[model samples]
Target: MLHRHPLRHAALLIPIAILAAVSSAQKADSIHYDEHTRIFRMDAADVTYAFGVNNVEELEPVYWGRAVAANDPLPAPHTMPEASSNDSAPTVTPKEYAGWGGGLYPEPALKVTFPDGNRDLVLHYVSHKINGDELIITVKDIERAVFVDLHYSIDPATGIIGRWAVIENKTSTPIMIEAAAAATWNLPRDTDYSLRYLTGRWAGEWQLQKQAILPGETVLQSKRGSTSHQNNPWFAIERGEHPDEESGDVWFGALAWSGSWRISVEQDQLQQIRVTGGFNPFDFGYKLAPGKQLETPKFFGGYSHEGIGEASRILHRFELTKVLPQGPMPKPRPVIYNSWEATEFHVDEPGQSALAEKAASIGVERFIMDDGWFGQRKDDHAGLGDWYVNKEKFPNGLKPLIDKVHSLNMDFGLWVEPEMVNPDSDLYRKHPDWVLNFPGRPRTEGRNQLVLNLARKDVRDYVYNFLDDLLSHNQIAFLKWDYNRNWSEPGWPAVAPDDQKEVYVEYTRNLYGILAELRAKHPGVEIESCASGGGRVDLGILRYTDEVWPSDNTDAFDRLRIQDGFTYAYTPEVMMAWVTDSPGWTNNRTTSVAYRFLSSMQGSLGVGANLNKWGPEDFATAKQLIEAYKGIRETVQHGSLYRLVSPRDGSETSVTESVSSDKKQAALFTFLHSSTMNYPYPRVFLRGLDPKTTYAVTSIYGRLSKDTPTSASGSYWMSHGVDVELKGDFQTAAFRFDAK
Candidate 1:
């Protein structure tokens, strides 16, 4: 029933101080491991991840779910009396840190290949250290001078465990690391295994895939030298017992690395699952010299008993407060306009100025001129490494376009591929040796560009200086830092033979350093990490960039699924969604402007459509939608998100809701892929709202039929959902609800 209140709707809205505090001030021995008992307990909000070490000195997982002690830790295989032999006994092959040892461990967490080709790694617990909010457990090889230290940092308030492993070379001889995983997460074997990961190629990225953790090993990796579009460094494990998103003990983990990475989910014969992740060990070996140490990227994971949405919320909160450069509470992302879709490579000062004017007309806050404003960059084939503006395109340099953009009250952003070089360009001709390649080896070219050897100090300085000069000379507020290709020959002839392999890790490190330097120099400038569309999006990159373009595909229909998969491990704030032309270049799928607008609104909305081609009606609709989006932008960007419906389920409808941190404002986005005959749109149950509070709903998209309640209790709206009978292809709607 609708609640009729005489007072204005604003009178009912109150700051959600209590909810905000709980979300922000949540505590850190919520996770504790006793030395005597050898038991580790990690508590997050409502769930607990517990594990214990057995008598054999092998770390084993105990339980992961709602709070409770692990019932009798698994017995050591050596002590079991079932006529204990090399096999036949109930052996736990999946250890907390798998290594080459007794009882066939399928996936090894630590594998070191010595000069003699010996891959024996037997690490036993040596000691432990407690330093305030973190625990460092050290283990050393039994036969070699190698020590591995596992560091676990727990944020008591959020219950997020930031875990990483450090392999220290204590031997005089340089040790060749065949494979060194960052962390091995052991999940409970009680429920049937189901693994969810994102996979795609090129234009189609973040295509979510879920299946049973089959026998042997299912490795999800990106060996293309970059974090390739084929696989993302994130995973979500859902036990069969609780398969659905809203009702499961969903265990999730992500590798905080932007370079080549891999995650192996090994399910042995017994159905036990052991997931290990870190730098991809294929064609990659880190050589550690005497007294040198190699620290793996932080691989963090958490358990959520409430469901996948809760798991995502926990991750979002952790990312916002811990991972990102801007700490804790972040400002709402502004509406951006990218000139690539509108102008393509034919960008000019006057051409971009016209687009910027059109962009500002529709409430675009950031005007980004992507590509072709620089040297000989008429197309993708040339002028990549050249950072200077094209005299032919921008006769007076980028200042004119930037100034015009700023004149329209929009922040100016430029696109630069600092890590790439055209094989036929002036920069490449000047420093042919600057590109990454082994001597006498044929270099592989991608997008008609070669990867720059940022690992080299000279190359890094050249690139940094040009970028710094560009930003300093122009009034650029943001930079779209793009890396279009991956490493080919994987070499650094400039460095020592042993130091050559360090290029893989050093390149990413130097890239981050450059970004940090740029930001430090220009405090007000923001950066977006774009690598052929989401290829380099990771916690490692997010620390530098303000946002990430998930993919090249802008089809509204396809974006729903991609955005959904992206949010599984990443928050929407970093997701840059664009509304392009009806027939998107990637999918060639035509969708209504409303559908496109609502779809993109789920994240940081951007308009990439050609304003010159838009009809009067299209512009009017876009202007209206842009204005409507601004009203709920803050709530959507920094709120608790609820995934009420899934497009992956093959259903006709998809739904989502976001509630402001204060719980005073909520925005709901719903989409109907295609309506069927006699099949009405089902009642949409609302979520992420205070059940006792009453909310006044106003339509931001579609019209609500008569007899529909204008306002209702949150409980009523959630329990007795609103039903719409709209029949159409690509039907979409949004509503703004204010607590009254």
Candidate 2:
């Protein structure tokens, strides 16, 4: 639900009077319907979306683009002209929600098969209701008892609309749903749009890919039983090839799903672009029983005429205020320190206490003890499903370590990978059938562990009970929940063969339910979702998680690109960026301490470096840098991000600026890969600031040009810009601006 704001009430007070001339005035940001014209117009922020019933009684898209005044004339609904006998009305017309029948050629919103072998299904508008910010439109099959309810809700703060559909089977026989989509969005005919999406592998995820939209279809999907790192469930379409960071019309969206999902961007025969996304149909089959219903995941979409950067800022605000758990007034993300880099699986009570002291000395707010603390988990080969503490490592259990961390003024967090089970663990030995596998088939293993079948009731209960008990016994304040592998040999022999395909949906549902229950039971504890890294980060998982590990590769240099592409769809509030050791583990590229810390401080800061190997200078530098970060963490986590200089295009420098919501505080970060021919950094301009307000600037790190002013008006900063004085390999700089 959207948080309460003045615009929310303004959206409710839509003028009902019909104007006869063009001189009439009406309030913006409203949703209204015209009975005579059979049109439904929704004005969200600066954009407008409308749809209505056509002459043939089918729902068709009317317009979706820049906002228009209420008195503006809109054409009455009419079916599109048919091209020929080969191109029927259903094929040419852009439908709001189309079924798989009546010679339809595009992607159908809903497809089903009857028990009597009849496949023809057509949907016609039945009824609609407007309640608060939501609009529900119901349609039914022409000659059957099947029904579909279309849901639309708009966020006043961001102009983003959430769309989904619920299908009901009211017939006496079961209906097999062959494929289902949340909603289909259509663009105007013959628009030159270029598609931009993210694609990458395990250690190298979130690489932005751009291509021109062709006549056929471009399918971006994940069939790995989870939101894979191969392709994220997000997309942005630019109106032309010349669109840049600051100017152009762009349309963007993201799906709120964690399971196997698919999004198809297709240009139809009439050259109309449409986006249809929902659960992947690769191995999808849902048998809806009589009187049962199925609801699809929500797909959110928005429009921005300012550019792709503004589109991202809009999504970022929507997520921080409406999508997250503690939105609108969320607590700041704590500066955390994880022990995995320090000792890995060799954690003990004294060693942990010593590390806690070092961490507390540097102002770490949360201490997370990563893997190898429980079961027989001395290595990746064993102790996954077993959730018990290691008796030999901690003779007095985790209480002493937890108590020690608590005494040092920090909350304690533990790492657990509950979805996986090693064959050498006691849990797997006792319940050999718990893992997902075909009967008598060889169970595939990743990281030497098999995925537990959370689709089964017994397995779900066991996993939940153990976690609940662990939290109930300890004073744990956070959990770094990790899932290390993808699904392989996914089978549930306990269920019937026809119903086995339900694992994809049921497993995700159970996982969400468990997280919901845990939050309800322990309201004070926070959770971070990590599937290896960036594997399961999506809107569905973000609803329960307080933060996310974006990637396993913490190399500061590589992360400049990784984190740059990440902010395109997600806010930095939930992105956990850690400062690891120099000579990075992934690329062996060493960066200075200031560079690494500043790179991580761009997002939620964390320290995963081995403190035991640090010299006094390292400790001193960390303490000072972290203090500077704390002064601006609020603005960094809940501010409008401006990508001044992108790290893409093989540029030698990268720059970003974050301005607070009130425009009073701003943080500027600059990085240089290497100096060449005595060249200086680019002139960086600040955005999202009040032009009339005067601001004072101070250096957080590095130095500015000798002639730079100490204070200036916001307009001066935007026009004249700032300059950095640096001449070295792997250099960094940061500055803070406070409104005077």
Candidate 3:
């Protein structure tokens, strides 16, 4: 049953459309079967992702990348080193999408503990069909009526294959699914592999870590019940040595799950390797009753033979054209001015009005009133779950601030943490049972807040009603949706004893449902996903949001690397980077205003500094910088990104270039962290430029240290490169190029 209430002012639901199937499966872009060998070949753009059923009726991978002419390439005769002589026959080899009952030591891709106490499940091919752009293959357990259907789909343009599974209990008995994954992707075993994944802490998220994929199961996961900041649910494998940002044959995959998830990369003793991803089993289990089914999240992967750069471009193109809201083309992100740093929790109508006026005087396109506008929320501990305006702060309601902001030619936005409640809030006081808790158990609290059980019908209804009413009553154009804490002691008491574990997954599902409903009601409003900051940012959350707060630490220097890690898996278009006060309260490093603006301009830019404290010079400089950013915003937001010099390489200078979609314009940013005693800077070779074209380059705002050539041939820029010189610490520069 769909959980939806009659929306007071709902519009025609603009259905989220899925990619249509290819004209014909037998055509060049899809599944083609070899009748003699029973081999299935799935062709993507420049790659071929194929798999076949072996003699034992288990799925085995044939090839995964750059199309080759070989047909039915089977494994050569080999003996297993991890098994005894009796069990060493090559006939018992581990299979792709391997299940239990096979002589498998590495984590099985699918593990379901049945009610009959038999954990072994040997799957045999049952049927195959192609419906539109997707190919569905059904497999059944040998002795049971359980059916597992595998879905394989590809977007022809990017060659990104989306894979997932559905496990159905066709029997009359209940099945306990402890460990079920979407799919396992197998890569060739002939080369040494290096694994790359993201990891970091609270205010510091998306720190990329790369190491050799040894002969063991290496897991990159998030068990915090949300896509945790500590580990991201994405992985990439490169051959032999660590590949630079621009070059290497890279295979990568990411899970489209907002809740607890895991991705395991395993290289067996015999050098065979596979990567499987899905829900994390920590504090998780689902009971599928008779005739019921369990569907897993989509695990999307792509191959980039050109290296990590092409990999990023592929993911970026797919996300831009398909996944993100306002599909195919993204709405241009506004230049935002947030009130959090200026007036953290001490919100008043007059103060915000003044800020709005100042914000408009400069060039802020959006004015966001962050936390403290809602009921009794003077601090973090109280007044959550109360959606009404705090009468004390905004005596009349948000209209006064909203009208003032709107009159200034800027859109108004607000911050909300709808899924949380404080003990002191009236909503929680009236409905304490609406939260996640086990009977008679101590409820664990983080940030003086408790997680509202959205998995419950009542709780979800309350959240949806408040959010819908807020949008209905206000002229809010955007919402900064924040999840401040992770789930601890997650339990749903109203649920049946054996089904409480479903809360881990159901909460995220309901959250998405509410977002969809809210969007359906108010099509004009956009959302930004924030967690204690960056904790819940992922492909899954990105689906519903227009932007994401990459981290709480907006100090431009630390952000260099943090943003690097984030862009490695996500596109910069959705990365909401901000220019904040410095010696940033978060990092205690002082930098010039120009340095801050240039760093933040690499993506969707925002300003979080206390503008009221700024002098006339600051305002003037800010206005100039904002105007300059606007001039090239589209190119930077939609352009192809090239990380010319990495901040992670322990270099004093970090450079990046973004060539526009039409190749007519490009924006380049350079940061000199610090300078040595009169040492000349390195010449930076630019990428993604046409060698035959001549370009007109100029600096924006003219705030940098040196002058670059007014015009240069693209061949000269690509070959001889440009030299950027700076003298002081935290100094930055930005230059724009026009193809002429």
Instruction: Rank candidates, TM-score, best first.
Output: 2, 3, 1
- Candidates 1 and 2, the one with greater lDDT: 2
| Residue-level lDDT tens digits of model 2 in 354-446 | 999999998899999999889888889998888988999999899999999999999999998878899998998999998889998899999
User: Alpha carbon lDDT of residue 272, candidate 2?
Assistant: 92
Error of 2 at 291 (Å): 0.7
lDDT per residue (tens digit) for residues 1-740 in model 1: 42211222231143111111112222344545543455566665566665554444555565655654333242221212223354432245446665664444567777777887777676666677767667788887767789999888876656777889989999889888878788888776643778888998777788889887777788999887778788999898887655676777788898888888889988765667888998888877788989999988889888887778888998898888888777587777889999998888999888899999999998899999998888888898888887777899888887778778888999998888888899989999999999888899898898999988888898889988998898788888888888887778888898788668777788888888898898899888888888888788888888888888898878898889888888988988889999898787776778899999999999999999999898889889999999999999988887889988888868788888989888889999999988777687888888878899989999989865566799998888889888764678988989999998
Q: Cα deviation in Å at residue 683, candidate 2?
A: 1.5
Q: Estimate every model's Cα lDDT from 0 to 1.
A: 0.80, 0.88, 0.82
Instruction: Give the TM-scores of the predictions, in the order they appear.
Output: 0.91, 0.96, 0.93
Which pairs of residues clash in candidate 3, taking residues 3 or more apart in a chain or in different chains?
A: 21-132, 21-133, 248-307
Clashing residue pairs in candidate 1 (N, C-alpha, C atoms within 3 angstroms): 16-662, 26-157, 27-156, 27-157, 28-156, 28-157
Q: Which 10 consecutive residues of model 3 have the lowest summed lDDT?
A: 3-12
- Candidate with more favorable, higher TM-score: 1 or 3: 3
